[model samples]
Target chain A: LDATAVADAEARQAGLVKPAGALGVLESLSIQLAGIARTCPPAVPGAPAVAVFAGDHGVLAQGVTPWPKDITAVMVEVFRNGGAAINVLSRACGASVTVVDIAVDGDVAEGVGTGAEVLSRKVRRGTADLAKGAAMTRDEALAGLAVGIEIANRLVDGGADLLLTGDMGIGNTTPSAALIAAFTGTDADLVTGRGTGIDDETLNRKTEIVAAAVARTAGVDDAINLLAEVGGLEHAGIAGLVLGGAARGVPVLLDGVIAGSAALVAQRLAPASIDYCIAGHRSVESGHIVALQQLGLRPLVDLDLRLGEGTGAALSVPLVQAAARVLNEMATLESVMAGPDA
Target chain B: LDATAVADAEARQAGLVKPAGALGVLESLSIQLAGIARTCPPAVPGAPAVAVFAGDHGVLAQGVTPWPKDITAVMVEVFRNGGAAINVLSRACGASVTVVDIAVDGDVAEGVGTGAEVLSRKVRRGTADLAKGAAMTRDEALAGLAVGIEIANRLVDGGADLLLTGDMGIGNTTPSAALIAAFTGTDADLVTGRGTGIDDETLNRKTEIVAAAVARTAGVDDAINLLAEVGGLEHAGIAGLVLGGAARGVPVLLDGVIAGSAALVAQRLAPASIDYCIAGHRSVESGHIVALQQLGLRPLVDLDLRLGEGTGAALSVPLVQAAARVLNEMATLESVMAGPDA
Candidate 1:
């Protein structure tokens, strides 16, 4: 019924063990689930699906990464070809990866019959450069969020008990940092990091640009307005996924900085939205740690992982599953005839 | 066929659409097969099993962890009752955990019915303190190695394609660090880390103790002598699992410092043993980095994780699966007709 309820349910399932508190944090998570679902033995099923939203940023034209903007489409091809990191990881996790062509430069045929299903929901070819104007209009931001919600709902209806959120958009971190700074009221410098391995000069420039974007949207208090001001379509989509996951009572694994920014925005939209969110890993990015701490969620993994292709979330899937498994399977001390005194 | 050939064939069958070289290291792995029997579409079945080897050290009488030596048996009961981190994580990975009561104060019932199967292969109920004399006899070391190999071979025969190596012996890290320092030719101070959150004073004492053990084992060149000089039976078993994995063609995921130390011993016995090993994570332990680098294996995750219950390897399982899956599932550019030119 509530977040605390879901957490309690998760703990009860975990506590039915032969040794009390033996499963550690895993048992704690079972309680977390109980609080959120307001039931014991929260029925988490198989058939989890991961939605990876890909887009392009007008800021990329400013030379954020060494690779060209066209590499985005090439990587879309890579994902379709099952050669990308996320593709390989998803297959290992036994979770299907669905790619959303939210803002590719050109019109790609819908459902071109790739390795995984491809969702063509282009809000625009690319976002407008935040340096020149708002990244997207309010209408566009809302549309992207709707697209994410639609995709998440479809996957759930199709029997995906879990939803993992990943993003594949270059230069999107600039907008992500800007949005995080706006929502958390942190200084842009503290929140932004050298994304995609930028040079010192570019890193400094990126930080300044993000700060300016945050300043521009200083008057906007609502998360949706902040998103419309500086957020990429992928960010909006991720925020929508978080909301959708909370609505469906499915845990959403947030990948990296981009996803963290989106989660912050989603929390602002719905205070209870944090219930469904699980921080996958603490990215090397400065903003990510701040964002995660602010959301009061600890990352399962903390590799100097800068890759934002849902790789972190994929790696953490087993850990989360372990948490659930301990809740469901471990035997209690009474059943084993092991006394508490013993 | 040899291990390399087997690994290569398995990689090829996983089926990446490109020329295979495009994925670099992952392609090479798909080619090698990691000891799986069949190369054609190397089917890595899901019934994962983790062997947690528990032992007691005479050094516990010298005071290492704040917990007493009796707690080792208590924890074993915790493991049996499914209250440990391994239980939670293993369940999360859909893996069955088996606890090997290799060393303890008293006789554990043969095939003691815990939620997990307990294999009592105790070597004199624990090793003598290395500070006093050799930790274990050379004959005992060999027998332990044999037991590890036997179990690994049996698991493979029983349809387990992947083997996760975990250890659970109190004050075992002291022996593990000593063994690592002896083999890696590193100073004990560099290799010995504050295991299990010891105080700074305890850490210094641990360093000195490990250094002394390394000094005693300096002349020993072979695994048998090394094990006799300063190795835990659990460590010896893990080394055998690494070699057995290569010999049997099942991938062995190394957990933490203990497993890393065991790997070093295995390499001494057979240099080609590195073929079947995958470093699961770069744990918080300082020795882990040295061992991983010496082995020339990159960890899939780097979470500063020091929990040595196969939690690191369990987390990396999805990534390993992903690497193989990308080879198998991703559509080739030719199939998609997307054109090789971006």
Candidate 2:
């Protein structure tokens, strides 16, 4: 981020027709965008792309979630068919969707279907049960990250100015909670939540599994190793998307708990990457709140969204565009006061 | 709202591929829209139009806000010129802007400027200083409301499915605060806020003025009488917008404190009108919070917006549209569960 551009944006916001701080978070968001774009008035972001990373969670073997693991592959197909929640929301907000098969347990075809782009970049079929051992090898985690970065690059190079993270993995919240607890040093019970609506007994069991997974990875301080130990393949891919989007000076709107956990890894890998990330919405998932707190990001929207196929993030695209548009298109106080001649 | 449609929407939500309550507020919002539209899956709102009601407050004489009364007229011009915050935001959200001069201290021409439609329907030049006496007669307040209804009808008939409220009046927040306090029975000190960023001293004085005005209107139990006693013309007009929009079964997205105060008037006049109103964003104004509480409305966006030119409401158009789209477009759980044939 360019500090001078941020200062310049601040000065410009002060001169806008509205009262100082009248636009609230939008004022600061515009300034942050200005810094990211290295321009006083950042371009109104168009061509937003949501990258939905599909993978399967090994933690499902522990009875963490009631949903079938095959649902991940099914959802990838649904997303490609433009019939999923993320697809509907992205289309409503005028953003394109790309489904990346980072590590789905089942096969997903690589091609464009309907209005979506499907990428075949599977790092592995699935991970081992993280409750008993590491979720994935360090090499596999790196490969997941590579896939994310590659997808991000492909989207941005293909004319995407804004990137959003989406994920599809049954029982993914278990690993998400474990990763959040591992990095933020929060208790598993506090960070764990029911994924896809689990019962009380299942939630309790999920918490125990999360606590054990965090304890197993307690010694790992490095982000990649921590991700490999307790995180799912989709989490690694999302982290890479964040890092890649930040590297390209494009903002990444993070979805729910899955994306939040990925962001923790992204932040750990490169602290400045956090600056380029926006908490799209606060999810109902407990770990998402902790992850947002650790990232020092305030969500633009809070609709209690827990279905993380980038629906929440996609819903916020207009707001992000509005923030930048206000900076670029609104008349300044001086201009308005100076009359039509000015 | 149609109860059967609402029930049907609820059933449809349950059958959606996502878990129950996963979409959170959006799910409820969709059901509300369904009820409002009297359809299980409401049509996605295609065209949203923001009616920016500009007026002047004689309460400006009391020094409640630092901005000159003339700035109201200037802002109306700015709105018409497509250079104000509201204009930029509305354009970003693909909503049209119509500037309605319900009351202004100065003359405003009635004509289209740039991309905006300007309507000159001034009931009066301005309200009387509320701290000194009643703001207007009951007739003027009714006329203000008539103008709002007429504009709402024109817009909706012209193809706007969503109506949004916008206000531009110097020193208007003082009357808004008084009106909120009068209707909600909240103390002035609790409801009054620094309009357009007032200093500590000015805010204190403003609070005192609001208290006095609320006291003056203590005996006015009727909505129109209460509005005439302490509300601005823009508030009355906005109340009408809410009423007219609701009568037409179109959703009205309300701006900040001023719109909230106006919605209180609308709700008083027609309790069912509140059903059609969506709190766009919670304002930083203390009065808006109380107004929202009294109205039993939760804001879709809470970016601390206080500009009150429909910027907040305009920004939420995409969310509202997405809410409806999700219900209409997303594949049902049965369809996904039944495999490709379904």
Candidate 3:
């Protein structure tokens, strides 16, 4: 952010129609946008795009979630057919949805069928069982990261002013919590949550798996090494997406815990990647708060949302755009004071 | 709120793409709209219109606000010329602005000029000094209420699916604080805030004025009596607008402290009227939180906003609309289960 641009924007904001900072965080958000664009009024954000990275987690073999791992392929098909929550929400925000098969170890080809396009970038099969051993090799994690970076480039090149992070893996939340616990130094028991509303017994088993994963990945300070040891493939993909968007100087709205974990990775890789990220909503997942706090991000909305489809991020598209538009559209107090109102 | 319709809306929500209540407050809001419209999917909210009620407060004599009373009339001219925050925000949300002279004391005709059309429904020149005596007579309060009701009726009949409550009274926060303290049984010192950033002395004086008004209006169990004795005419008008919107089964977005106070008055007048109200944003005013809590309304946005020009309500129009559209346009999970994914 430019100091002179920020000062200028603040001076202009003081001259707007109402009391200074009366719009709450929205006022500061607009000023932030102005500084980002280095203009008094930043360009109105173009239609947003949500990239739902679909991958299967090998942790499903650990009974981490009640849903079958096959559901990942099923949900990917659902997303492509425009019948999922992400699809509905993205369309509502006038945003496009792009599904990428980063690493789904299933009949994903059949899921796409003929004439249905899909990003078949598989970094090998689904990640290895983190509870038993490493989730992926370092090269595999790097492959997923490259796939995500490519997708971000395509979305931004397609004229999207903003990118939103989404995921579609049935048992992904378990790894998300493990990633958070590993990075934020939170206790596994405290950060773990029941993904997809599991029974108490299943939740306990999931917790133990998360604890094992965290323990296995301990002492890993490198971002790629940490991800390769325990993080899911989609986590790496979303991390790449955030890094890529920041690299382009575009904003990326993060969904709940999964995106938060990815953001932790991105921030570790490039400290400034956190600048492009906006936390959309805090979810029911306990790890979300810790991950967001570790990254120093404030979510826009707070509610009981645990679905991992970038749906929460999609909901905040208009709000983010509104913040941008307020910079351009609102009349400065100087303008109004110089007019008949003064 | 119809129990059957709410239940039906919930059932429909369960069938949506996400888990039950996964969409957060939006799911509950859509269900509320369903009950209000008496349909599975409520009518799509039409383009919104903000009725910025401009009034004057005789309480300015106490030096509560540094701004002159004439600024109300000046902002009305600014609103007429589309050069104020209200005008800018309303347009940003694709909503129109309707400047209503409920009881502004200045040269309002000069403010509106000869050719411009404005709603001139003044109940009086301004409000009486609540510090000295009753702010309004029973007849004056009723007249103010009627003016608000008429504007509500006209706006809704003119095809506004939602009515946004706004006010442009310089010293209005004083009355708003008084109303909240009185109705919520809160301490005046607790609920009063520095309107437009007052100095220590002015804030103390404002607090004293609020305490005085509350003490004078004590034992007034009747809602109308309470309002007539200490409320500004714009407060009564805003209360009437809420009542009218409820009568017509339309949602009214309450701006901040003024709207919160107004909603308190309206809810007292009709206990069920709260069902037709939506809190726009939590403001910097302590009284706003008190009033919102008294009415059992959760604001959609929270920020450091003390500006009361319906700007908060205007900002939330798209969010409210998105909630409504999600219910209508989203494909049910049941529908998707029958598709290729299943």
C-alpha lDDT values of all predictions: 0.75, 0.91, 0.83
| DockQ comparison, 1 vs 2, better candidate | 2
Q: How far in Å is the alpha carbon of B236 misplaced in model 2?
A: 0.5
List model 1 lDDT by residue over B1-342, tens digit each: 355656665445444333223234444555544344345445654766788787888877666666566656766776776766677666666677777777776656556444467888776688888877788899888878887887788778877778999888778888888887888899999999877778888888888888887887766787788887888888978887888877886888888889988999888898887777888777778988888878887776665556676777776676566556655555544544456553
Using Cα atoms, each model's DockQ against the true complex is: 0.23, 0.89, 0.55
On TM-score, the stronger of 1 and 2 is 2
What local lDDT does model 3 show for residue A269? 91
Error of 2 at A94 (Å): 2.1
lDDT of 3 by residue, A1-342 (tens): 666777887887777777777767777777766766667777877768888888888888888776787778777777777767777677677888888888887856534422123677888778888888889999999988998899899999989888999998878998899899999899988989876688889889988888888887767899999898889889999999998988887789999999998889998899978877888888888889999999997877664667879978987777777777766766666776677545
Q: Lowest lDDT 10-mer window, candidate 1 chain B?
A: B16-25
Cα lDDT of model 3 by residue, B94-155, tens digit:
78788789899976663443212368888888888889999889989888889889989999
Error of 3 at A115 (Å): 15
Give the alpha carbon lDDT tens digit for every residue of A1-342 in model 1. Answer: 465666555445534532243334445555655555556666554566778898988877666555567767766767765666677777677778888989877655666334567789999998988866788899999999998899889888888877888888778889889988988899989988877667788888888888888889877897777888888999999999999988888888889899999998888889788877888777888999888987888887665567677877876777667666655665553444465564
What's the TM-score of each model vs. the native?
Answer: 0.79, 0.98, 0.95
Screening candidate 2 with a backbone cut-off below 3 angstroms (N, C-alpha, C), the clashing residue pairs are none
Candidate 2 docking: what grade? Answer: high
A1-342 per-residue lDDT for model 2 (tens digits): 999999999999999888899999999999999999998899989899999999987878899988988888888888988888998989887899999999899888899999589999999987779999999999999999998999889999999999999998888998999999999999999999987798999999999999998998867899999999999999999999999999999999998899999999999999999999988998988888999999999999999888999888998888888899888988888988877765
Task: For model 1, state the Cα shift of residue B178 in Å.
Answer: 3.4
Better lDDT candidate (1, 3): 3
Deviating ranges (above 4 Å) for candidate 3 = A109-117, A340-342, B110-117, B340-342
